[model samples]
Target: MNEKFTGIVLFIRPHREKDSLVKIFTREFGTKMFFVRGLQSPNHPLKKHLIPLTEHRYWGTINQQGLSFLKEGQTHNLFRSIQSDPFKQAHAAYLSQLVDASIDDNSEDQQLFDIFEAALCSLNEREDARPIQLLLQLKLLRRFGLRLNMNSCVVCGSSQKIEDFSMTHLGVLCHNHLDTDPNRMRLSYKQIKILQLFNEIKLNQLGHVSISDQSYKRIDELIFMIYHEQVGIKLKGESYLNQLYKVADQLKVSKIEGT
Candidate 1:
């Protein structure tokens, strides 16, 4: 019997000469791998719908052992605009890979699916994808139960001014407790406020908030550190993302110099 699923393609790998194995994060079934025969064929109708970050309606059959076989698929949203820009494309790749690595197979989480959908749509529409990326990472971290306690000092439970962030304590450290962890990263009150904003706001409501590049960098550093120390998974796309950002910065500099 065949089952129908609507999901985004997270990752794809070549299987033999003519087939491909795809990892899809579905709203109904969470993450699942599907075997698609003739996916690499020149005339395959589903070829265009198999790209990473593209949403599709997948029709397939699951074997008794629980492997999915793709019968047919139709595109839901190709997000062509995201593919048109190299920077957006790289970020999309990063997001897809991150989600694919972090979430377990057959683990259905509708909230995560919703967040990823909103994030991909937002990235396709927004001029600057960094802020949305940051927001999405924060949301994912929270969803994974690795959330940082920004509400108060984790060490002393003080809601007063936070002076630093401690990976050991898993939250902000007040000035009084700053000495408790020498390895803590110092954070200004403004930075703490920005992080709080990130935690409180929804991905779709990010237009009302603005973040500086310096602030984003700091937050990203902290969040990536948290992922490393807490979650212990290194995102495979980080190096490529760094290269893309460097190239984008150079292009911006060149355009500014020309003007």
Candidate 2:
């Protein structure tokens, strides 16, 4: 007998004989993979509902491999902003990959699902989604038990504030408690607060807050460090971001010289 579910499609792939396999991030069951036979046919019930970020109510059955057979499903929300914008689409893909890679199979995380939904909403509406996404990723990593100690010194736990931060220590190393490590990056108070605030805010309330360029850079650095520490790899989109950063820096330099 097949079980039924309500979920958002996180990823999709073509299967054997024109069928499709979909990885759903569900509301109840965490993440699941389902097979939709004859799904490529235009008349197939689920054909149009197969796109990424498409939320659906699924009627399916669980099999021996934890795979489900899709009997029926209906679209919940066709997010026009996310589906229409190419850059937003790309960002969504990147975020999906990160979540997929970070989480293990058959594990249930309701909190994570909620976080993802909030992230998707933020992506659709926010003007500065990159910084928001970066903040979300950092918070998500911590929620999964990878806490980045941004407050005080990691070595001495002093309240002296973070003077210099590092990807190596995964947080700030206060001046008084600074070890002999020469590979640390310097960070300001503004940067440290932004990283901390990302996890602390309700998703909908993010609109009320704004970040400075310096704080954004710090969050970016912290995000890169978190990815390296937790995922043990670099994000594919990071090089392009780095190039953009270099270009922005050069433009700023040129403007400063002109003034």
Top lDDT: which candidate number? 1
Error of 2 at 53 (Å): 1.6
Weakest ten-residue segment in model 1 by summed lDDT: 62-71
Error of 1 at 111 (Å): 2.5
Give candidate 1 misplaced runs (Cα > 4 Å). 64-66, 251-259
Q: Write the per-residue lDDT of candidate 1 for residues 1-259, one digit (tens) a residue.
A: 6888889998889989999998889988788888888888988888887888889998887543466888788889988888898888888888887777667888887878888888899989888888777777787785567878888999879989777788888888888999999888777678888887777788867874577767766777888888787887777777788777778779999999999
Angstrom error at residue 98, model 1: 2.2
Error of 2 at 211 (Å): 3.0
lDDT of 1 at 45: 84
TM-score (C-alpha, index-matched) for candidate 2: 0.81
